[model samples]
Target: MTVQSIAGPRFSWRGPSNGWRQREGRGPTLALALFILVFSLIPVGRLIVAAFEGGFGAFWQVLDAPDVWRATRNTLVVAFGSGSLALLIGVVFALILSVTTLRARTALAFIMVMSLMIAPQISALAFKTLAGPASPLLKLVGLAPAPGTPNPMLGEFGIIVVMGLHHAPLVAITLASGLASIPRPLIEAARLDGASPWQVVNRIMLPLLRPFLLSAALLAFVAGTGNFGIPALLGLPVGYVTLPTLLFRKLASFGPATIGDAAAISVLIALIAGTGVIAASLLLARSASRLETDHRIEPFWELGRWRPAVEAGVWGVIALTVLLPLASLLATSLVPAYGVRLSPSSLTLAQYVEVLFRQDLTVRAFRNSMLLAGGAALSLAVITLVSAYVLDRAKPKVKAFAFALIELPYAVPGIVLAIACILLFIKPLPLIGVSIYATPWIILFAYHARFFAIALKPVMAAMATLDDAVQEAAVCDGARLGQRLRHIVLPLVFPAVFAGMLMVFLLAFNELTVSALLWSAGTETLGVALLSLEDSGLGAEAAAVAVTATLLVLVLMLAMQMLARRLPPNALPWQALAGPDRERRG
Candidate 1:
């Protein structure tokens, strides 16, 4: 029997089962369902009501404005442009690392993935310090622009480049896994038939990787279009606004009519993103059935004397894309003043000490960030495990709608979701009084919605691997549902849960856009605090906060890396389970 059949009945009741035990058993699940309904579904409903309550008149006015059109066009252009660029760069790196005989390929892969570990705002700040008008490199070349010079390279183009680089690691890793799925024998056969390298890639490799590439592209597009941080930091200074920034501008005015118009924009963004996510999921599902492991590493093509040059190129790209920007940020933090001559006398720890000691906001921001991150991490872990178990272990009987419901928020941007929360909870409800706006809970809920997919994916993937026989054996021994989860399931899936927790923690701590909208006085997170300082012409203080925040993130990331190392190699259980099925057929 298959694992699903052996796992026992989907629903069962205990003594005196007059449907009372069944109903009682469902109490926890029902409570969870209601919680999700009220938290997730209700907010969305409010957003919809707010959108149409204005009679669509205000929406039309906003949509018809020339500035709105400009913003919309700019948003699309930047998203598409950045997504395409990221895909191209990702594909190149993936190909080289996966197929070539380059030195330090493994290290290159790690560096690529590490870029995504840092928040986008942090990455943009690094780039701005490196490539801005006062950059040391510009000065060295005697090409330093005048003070207050408008550098186009550091405006819209720079925003796209930074965002593209920020997301490329995910694209590269996903595409590399797809490329790794292709059979070595097929490539060898084509080679034996005297196919050129270009021909082999164009006709064979490219065709096989189409599904993965398309999915990655769609994901990148959604992320790029919805992203607020990069645009807020890099583009705002140059008057290059996108949808999220435009919506923020409107809502900050706090006019009821204007807020309704912003809600309309938020709904529109969510709809567009949701449609893309659904399309990508459908496409991926079709391709998933054909996926098989073909892990045989083919013989590397000899570059002979050209190998050194190839290695040099790969290292150069990594340094340019990741290292240089970070170094610039670090260097700038020590300088006494912006645009000052780079001399030993100019370097001091005064800014750091001042920001750390004199600014009470910095300490409060750190405490708030910790509270949100810790709470979100713990909450998501429990929710993800319960949901994953229900979906993977219970299967068909659990309702397919559950999966759809969980996946719905993947396409919704943080900014739009924040608006939904505000629109929904700002009014007094029957049972739940008090508006959620200006409360820290709103930030927590936003993080949950934004990162629910990420936290669940790894857990679901791990759960898919375990043989159902193990669970059945435990059930046959009279282990209850809670016991089964605590003893049999939880121990096995804990690694994945831990990894997911680490990721959620990192993301929550560094989160900006949603917090920026939701944060009230005294609830400042590091991200918003840094942005506020920058906006208020406290560049030195902002740099100090930025440095502290980056170091904290790096420390957490290092801990996660260590945890990942300690975990079992086959923590990705779904792949392990799928491998045997494919091998049996072969």
Candidate 2:
């Protein structure tokens, strides 16, 4: 029988029967495979080739650099440190929200997740502003660190702390999904056996969630390793460079002259990230448990007397991690200049006016970011809808390989993908003979390759829910493949399609890593513009840019939050936010 789940029906993504493939013929399957290979596999493969263009000598040359090795060491240490921290924070929030009567839990969960959508650089900037000697927020409270005192957030430790805070929500989202899988019967049996709420969690839930914990840890670790903005802002100024920042410095300093060297470094990064993924996969496989059930986890303990204290504690954490930093960022944006104390008399809107209206570069960045992100989102929505159908009907082996290719671009460091795009498209196309290098097209191409999977996942999951019976009936009634897809499947799955589109746009809009290497001239994304303003010593202007971008992300997130209520369970990343509400409704 098909699995019944917490959200309702748990749709298996297992491909349809071989007969469906036969009727559709090889055209769609081949087309999808080609699309995936061209966009994903080809770029990565081309990057690998570029890394070895000078044989083993060039690759070894990159590895031999003292700075390269130092950056690698730093990357590993920071990734593990931040990842462990994220695990701790995530598990606490997940358990508390799942099992305890935490008041304002919905708002807490929403804020926690919304924190994640704040761009990494913006986060770093905010915290930096908050802790700096001239911190407007701190100065206004007469607690700014004294001038000539070194900023506390300008080194390795700060990178780990900021990144950990930035990524904890990702861990929470992952763990929340696992928490929902826990069968209610097991918890009920424990309760009947006189087990306390804590006992049920420690004795049963955590063990079952081991696989998901490992998965979350891996996600946090990989994200840490690939993260550019955090290291760029927090680590780079003090010469505490990670691999990503090292790459950025290399190319930014020497431009095209260092492309070969950057490719070699990118190869090293991909290997490190890939090794981590493989290890995590092995760990997860070992820890796997069959957790499927109709009953989802729900609150087991009512903290009546302690509720206020617990709510206060949770809100305090939120304030420190999210609200304070953003407040500092806003204060910085309003100040007439960086390091100026924020006051009613000192505040000005000049930075916002300059960035939003007067600066040609910033204005173009806004337009470019929207076009690139909106284009990628729209294109992937259409492509994923078709690809999901083809994949759903393809042979198991074909489907698995295609899935791997689709994920590879996104899973590996964005720097790797950016390097791959440069390698693949640096020269003129064979037929067109027009180079896309140093142009917006390069950035757009990287977005498509990197975010294709993001757009595909929700759509694929939605495809899994399609009823074979309904399709068969449609076919029996003389409906063609195209007709059935157009009339029946598309309408049923449009919510997921829209959700995926929103996800892609959200990620692509404020993204920096890919465009860091790809962007040129008038083609700057918002991320590029913000970094430029900061580097040019226009900190107030940079803060304005960050605030603008963060507001847009929050607005989109709220819209998606409203949209998620109508989607099938787990169709969006923030689906975890809906679980407790779903439980309440049930």
Candidate 3:
């Protein structure tokens, strides 16, 4: 058919084409430009002002102080040590699970993700209750030492271990995804060519997974460097100070100079984290671009006589890394006293009851957590959806900048964002009438800024996969922009929207560093309340609260997994792995 006949003789080619392009491209681009300017640039500008105005001078003057040097050294040591440990464990676990005939593969996957959901403070608390000076396990092992003796697990060693354990699941998940993406045929071919298992793994698996491994490790390093909960909970008791803890101390200290120095330190940490993220991205892109796709499926190998032994070893590692600390926490929460041996006589539900019913703070903290998380999740979902859609539909000239701005927070740490929020909102703007301090809304805002990038990622990824032709077809059938979005776009992108909401809610509910700094007496989150309880020597109550928070987070994560499963087939990672079978169903 002729073009004119097909489209209609009355239709003009140039007018509609131009109008549609401008509507889809120019309108969204302008919106994104304004959004970035308001959300990212303004807050960052305030941070820069705080950093240079008086903070820079004071920070410079104290840069050479012994205490500053000690803190810097401690920070690097803990970050690097924990990062290295996490990398080793993650790589080993990934290898075993991906390449072996592991019996509990599905269970292991759940366990790994569950470990990731456990907050760092909770993990540290668990470790403390398991191995601390007053721990029942220590006494049972005859390693409790003297009553006044210092506990080794409450110092630098404990901080590194807790951080590593807290972050290892992230590393494992990232590396496992990369490993699973590797074509199985290549490994089979290497084996058929007489390559040993070790040789094939070293030559094939390692090289192919390098980019993902590096990205995971670098991300973990950034997290470890900025982490406050583990260090504060474990290291502070032993007089160890990391950069984030130092910044917190400086801010809480009743001195203007200390606050300025805190601002300077925040700026420095943010810059370092930003640089690491950029470098990792560039490296990953370069490496991935060089890789050629291999299409081959290999059969799973039988472990023969060694299968049982290998399976047992895999379970042992998982138990040690995942189950032990969790059990320790659950046991401690149920026990009456830590120093007493864990027999039937020592078990009690009194701690949970005391914390749940006797303490009003527990109820208040739970309410505050729900409020903060709900606000953050709702705000983040709206902002991220708008931002993602704008970036997805914007003109080429502005799209790149908008996307980059949205992603900038991925590099910035929570502590830095919290500091920036304080700087920006302390002085009320014309539109906003009051200071943000001690307000639950401030916690919500800080969470939105800190986690906005995480929400944007999945939404943008889902948006990218959508067929633009459907929208065009709707338009051709007389659907307006709003109608098309409401009827078609929303339904298709619902999975992504849900995923984004789930992630934001999970993060906001469990967040510590940002909330710790921003929380007021009346607006304390569960995490902050738990920390307070711990500091006041209410160990049993703190453990109960930690256990309760962990359970809530786990439930939310499971709900998210179920929601993802109900999504259209193409929207899931597992469906993609199923290949032709999944395609036919979709």
Clashes of each: 1, 0, 0
lDDT comparing candidate 3 with the true structure = 0.72
lDDT of 3 at 494: 76
Give me the runs in candidate 3 sitting further than 4 Å from their true place. Answer: 1-21, 24-31, 54-59, 136-149, 180-185, 255-257, 292-302, 337-340, 394-401, 567-586
Predicted candidate 1 versus true structure: per-residue lDDT over 23-92, tens digit per residue: 2366456645764675567777788888877587866765777777888888888888889888898888
Listed in order, each prediction's TM-score against the native is 0.88, 0.94, 0.88
Backbone clash total for model 1 is 1
Which is the leading candidate under TM-score?
2
lDDT of every model, 2 decimals: 0.72, 0.85, 0.72
lDDT of 2 by residue, 1-586 (tens): 2322232222222234554455566766776887788888899889888899999987898889999999999999999999999999989988888888776676788788878888899999998888978788899999997898888988988899999999998888878877887888888899999999888889899988988898889989999999999899888778898999999999889987888899999988998888777676555544544676688767877677888888789889999999999999999999999889888899899999999999998999999999999999999887898899988766767776788789889989998898888888888989989999999989988999889998898888888878766765565567776887789989989888898898899999999999998998889999999888888888899999999999999888888778776676766555575364544311
The alpha-carbon RMSD values of the candidates against the true structure, listed in the order shown, are 4.8, 4.0, 4.3
The order of the candidates by TM-score, greatest first, is: 2, 3, 1
lDDT, candidate 2, residue 114? 78
Query: After superposition on all CA atoms, how large is the RMSD of candidate 3?
Result: 4.3
Question: How many residue-pair clashes does candidate 3 contain?
Answer: 0
